[model samples]
Every structure is written in C-alpha cells, then in structure tokens.
Target: LIYIYDLPADYNARLLQYKHHALACTWRGFDAGNHTYLKDSVYAVETFFHEALAVSSHRTFDPEEADFFFAPTYLTCYMWPVHGWADGPWYHAPIPNPRPMHAANFIDEVGRWVNATMPYWSRRGGRDHIFLWPHDEGACYMPSWIYNNAIFLTHWGRLDADHVSGSGWPPDNYSQPVVYPRFQPLDWRRMYKGHLCYTPGKDALIPAFKASNSYHRSPLVGVPPVKKDVLLYFRGDIGMYREWWYSRGIRQSLYRLAMEDKWREKYN
Candidate 1:
C-alpha cells in the first residue's frame, strides 16, 4: 500500500527536514550494507508542474506505490493535448486551435513545488522521466511511460512565442524528446552573463522572456550581482522573423501576419 502525505502549513521547511532524515537513513544503510548496489539501483522520482519545465531542466516527482509521500498543496496536476504547435504563427496570432483542449496553469506550479521540495530526487533514478499529466486526489493518471511518450509525440510542435517572459523555452518546445543536461562548470557564471534580459544559450535563450524591468535582483538563487535589464524586446516590425525576435511583443506581428494572406501562406 502507498502512503502519501499532503504538505502542512510550513511545507518548505518541513520538506527540508524530510530530505535530511531520508539522506541520513540512506547513508546509514550504505554503511551497514557495505555495498553500493542499493544506492546505485535506487532512484527517487517526483512530478513537477509543467510550467516550471519551461524555465529549468529538472523533473522532480515520482508516483510509486510504496514509500513515496508528498505534500499536494503546493502542487497540482497539469493536462493538455500533445498535438499542434503553439509556436510562431500559433502563439503570435489568436487562432482557434481545437487540439489544445483544456488550457490550465497548475502544471508549472506543481513542477516547481516538487523540484524545490525534493531537490535530489530527480537525479536518483538511472534515467528519470518526470511524467506530466492531469490527476485527481493527488494521484497521477498516466498509465505507462509509453503512454506518456505517445501523448508527447502527438502534441509536440513549435511554440509561437520564442520565450516566456520569466522562463526560458519549454522542454516540449522543439517537438521532440531529448534530454540535454547542463552541468555546473566554473564558466557557468560567464555563460549566463547576458541571461538577465535574454537567455544566453543557443536554443532556450530569448531576450524577450526576461523579467520585468522593475526586478532588481537576479532570478537565479546563489548568483553574483549583475546589472538588471528588461526582458521584453518591444521594438520590432510586424513580420514573422521580427515577431520571433520580440518574444511577447510577437502578438502584434502575429496579428499583422495573420491578416495578410501572403504572409500567412509563408507560415503554412
């Protein structure tokens, strides 16, 4: 039987305590066992809110039957169709996309909560797959990893907006399933220099998804002080290429392109 615990009022602090205890027990077990197989084979899993997947490359949740308990208040299930592309033409212009079906906001919140709470769980498994799907009564509804993959393939497509205002490009943005890991090297700080207003990487970076201008502190947790910059690139013309560049302001370009049949064909 599985025993799950919903988080308490002071959830974050309590989660930390749980992590400490779990680690202590694991370490003691390691010492007593005198073998690393138990540690090597064991993997902790957690599910994250889908929205949080847009910003970071961590999936921190597992819905196993035994020995898995998580607080559900900070987390919620996320569900959406995995077909059609939400990029460029889709995000730029408001079209009646029938497949997106149910648009909801709980995915991101849930993903962030899990990743933040169980910081180490995502790295535990041999190859972790953070399943994303809707749920009821704090239990995941996904049947198999194969189902998760199929649903993802059906929905995979380009995003209309290159970047989100606060988060980077999402995991499913490219319309494929490939995990790219970013390790912390000494040059990590240098790599993220211009990331204040724009993502500095080749794929995920977008200048527009930057935080609002009023934000004075760095978005990352333990990073050095850097000059604050606005994330949205508001100055651009009304065209597909320019829209892709402007991030949020692409809405204007999307309208212009959609109204003109000639440009619309270019997208099709």
Candidate 2:
C-alpha cells in the first residue's frame, strides 16, 4: 500500500550514523540498546515506524502499484543536541540552542532537491505522498508547498507552536526561520507554511518509539482497562532548563504547599 522513495542518504539513512556518536543517539534512542523488544521511548518512533513500513506487507516496490508514497527523512536526529555525561549538554543555559537553523537549512535543501530531481512529486502535486516528521513541533518544521500537501505522521500536533520567545530552545524543540532562494510566499505571517503543527483532518499522529522487547517488563500492557489507582502520571522530567527563571516556577511553590501538614489530601 505504500511506496518508499529512494532518497539520498543525507536526508534519511545518513542521519542514522549519529547512533554511534552519543548514548542518546542510539537506535533505541536514549541509548536503550538494540536487543530490547518492548521499547517505550517515544523519540525512537521515526526509526521503528520507518523500519516497519520498509518490511511490511503493505509496502509496494513499484510506485505505480502503490496507494501511498513515503519519502523518508529524519528531522530530529539532525537537530538533536550533542551532549556528554560530564559537563552536560553542549549548550550552556545562557546560550540558546542553535541546531534548529541547521535542521531548517537541511529541510530547505531537501525541498529544492525534490522539486528539481524527482518526477513523482509533481504527480497530482503529491496528494498521495507521506512523510515521517518526528520533531518536537512536528509538521510545522516541514514546508507546506512541498511535503505539506501530503500526509504527515508526526508526534507533536500543535498548529500554533512558534517556540515563542526562544522558550523551547533545547536545540531540538525550538522554531527557526529559513530564507528560501527564488521561492516566494504569499503569506509571511507564519515562519513556515500552513502556520500550524497539524491540520485537523489532513495529518495524523504517530506514537514515539518503543522497542519490541520493552513490553516484557510491564504486565499491565494490555487492552483491558485496569482500575485507576493514582493521579499525576507524568513520565518526563519536570524542572528548570535554566536557573535564572524556569517557566514552570509555579510548580515548586505548588509542591511545597502540597507537602504542608495542612494540605496533604487536597489541592494538587
């Protein structure tokens, strides 16, 4: 049902070379290892999703016989910050992460390449095409004029994520504007085309990566609805990216207030 395009390595396969660069850049993401079957890391979705489609029964080798065409590209791996376990992430707290610009340029280069070299993209203006854009802000990072016309499988589904005021600047999640050569847009109000992360009916949401063996540890991983036992089920870290002023400053205050003897049972 799907035809996978043979894109150059730079945009797709070459990005996988990062897996050896850092622990966080592993094939399982967050360095979870390769033997795990039940992977839970949401960041590895791009690899697993693409791998599934590549070997799935639904994939068609001949473009003419395909219902959908998939052009593989890994946007997050390019923007993923290079960090070590010692001093920490490459970017200092005061200095904002600057990888988004690089990622945007790579995207722009891909757009131009497809427009110039690929013949299939012009077919019905790519209505039957599909892309895997697993960025923090998701589809907002892709150009609407090219890939946007097709289906986008992304993690973030916000249509209005601007990474406002450089807030989500961990090098991976912020918004960066790109200036195109010879390409003009009618609307400039938004940095990227369509001015949104997701369009209601057109785009679809894909889950983050989960290695197959990862499910072995969790016995509660099933369809049956278990009893709701506790509240506040958060998985990610909740703290400041900077010491000066973390946006979630109110959380610390709320935690302290809740711990008080007078307010244990209520007001979360």
Candidate 3:
C-alpha cells in the first residue's frame, strides 16, 4: 500500500501558485479548467498522479500499513520556467513570476522537513520513501544523501546521463535547475556527473504526464467503426532534424531505418 506524507502546502501547492506555470501552458495552446489548470504543462504529471492516488482505493491512511511512502513534492513545476530563452513573454511582464529557490536547495529543504517532522524517513533512512521527480533529466541533480537510499518516480532514465541542457533558459530572473557554464567542456561535466539518476531495476521511470481529459473520447468526435490493422508502435524522443545524437543515437537509427518500406509486410 502507498501512503502519501502530509507535507505542508509550501512544498507542493505553493509551487503551483506561481502563475508562470499556467502561463507556460495557456500560451502554448493548452487551455485549462477544473483541477486541470496545470494540465498541459509538460512537467505537470505529478499533479495528476498525486490527485488520482489521493482519492483512489490504493492510498492507505496508516503509515504502518504502507509499503511505500510517496513524497508528493512537485519538483518538476518548481524547476520549469516560463521559457528557456530570453524572448519569453513573461520575461518583460509588468508582474513577473516570483523567483523560486534553487532546485538543489529545495530538495534539501524537503528532505530535511520529512526527516524532522515525521518518523517514517528516520525509520528506514528513506529507503521506503518514493520521491516524485518529473524533471527533464529526472532526479539527476538530487543530493546523494537523499536519493541514494530512496525510490524516485521520474520521467527520464539514462544510464549515461549528462545533464548538458539548462533546466530553465540560462538565468534571467528565475533561478533553478542549475546550468553548466556556457564554456564548460564535456569532460568537466562528466567529472561532476551526479549519482544514480536512474538505476533501472531499483528506480521507477514514469511516462510524461498527460491529463485525463485527453483520454476521454467524446461523442462529437466519434471514431468510425472498423477493424484496425496498424501494428508496430513506438513513442518518445525520435531524433528528428538534428536533436544532437539524442536517444543515444538509437532514435536516430530508427528514424532512418523505419523509412524503408521493404520491412513493412515482413515486420507487420
């Protein structure tokens, strides 16, 4: 059974109060309503996950009955910015987004709070705790003291993870997801590579969050009744138009190979 720690709103809800997150979505054509206010933001998955389990039959109120403790911290939204580049509308808005603390510092804050305010983390030293890390590179930057022992629910899993990308567009007013200096060579980053971003069998890798409304089939958009024949399916970073040897070049290989019509009949 899963038990969600009753962390204070400052950890989760307060982060959502940052209007820039909603702005990141609404400006991208993702209209929001109801509890789906954060729906279309790429990092908004934890909101959906936490909301579902909170009301679902799987959540246990008693900590003793819980197999895994879910720390419902919204790290992704905390890290995501209005834009990665300076041209973002919010950059010059009259009322701009309030700066959030650095992600590393936030992680430390959450870790310290749970350790002191509750007994669960101390019991097993956080081995049974589950952290929600919906960042682009997952919990790559999480401190070793916390992540080394706990479980991470993340969106990315890379064995050779090198977070060369900036979490937000390189520092404007908002500070988060620390970026490597513009001139930091690949070797320097590799030297400072973090601990166990995702250790396959040990950690859980979740999908990019999608809102439930997207799954609802409407009568107005009824599908034609017919037998479907399409077979092979794949989703994720298919490196199109030079994504810089992305997916470790696996997606690149597939992108090229999948173009051959010769395998259509045989593979299907």
In terms of TM-score, how similar is model 3 to the real structure?
0.66
lDDT of 3 by residue, 81-134 (tens): 432322322211222232222454466678888999889988998999988877
Cα lDDT, all candidates: 0.27, 0.57, 0.61
For candidate 2, the lDDT comes to: 0.57
* lDDT over C-alpha atoms for residue 60 of model 3: 99
Which candidate number has the best TM-score?
2
After TM-score superposition, what is the CA distance of residue 36 in candidate 1 from its true location, in Å? 52
* Candidates sorted by TM-score, best first: 2, 3, 1
Between candidates 1 and 3, which one is better according to lDDT? 3
> How close to the true structure is residue 76 of candidate 2, measured as C-alpha lDDT?
64
**Model 2 TM-score, all chains together:** 0.67
Error of 3 at 244 (Å): 1.1
lDDT (Cα, tens digit) per residue for candidate 1, span 1-268: 2223333432222322333233321212345558532221011111222233323333234445333232332211111111132221121113222111111112323344555665433544312322322211111111222222211111112232332222122322212122223321232112112212211221121121222222445555544766545233332245454424334455555566568657446533
* Residue 196 lDDT in candidate 3: 60
- Positional deviation of residue 106's Cα in model 3 after best superposition, in angstroms: 1.2
Q: Tell me the TM-score of each prediction against the true structure.
A: 0.19, 0.67, 0.66
Model 2 weakest lDDT span, ten residues long? 85-94
Q: What is the lDDT of residue 167 in candidate 1?
A: 13
Best by lDDT: 3
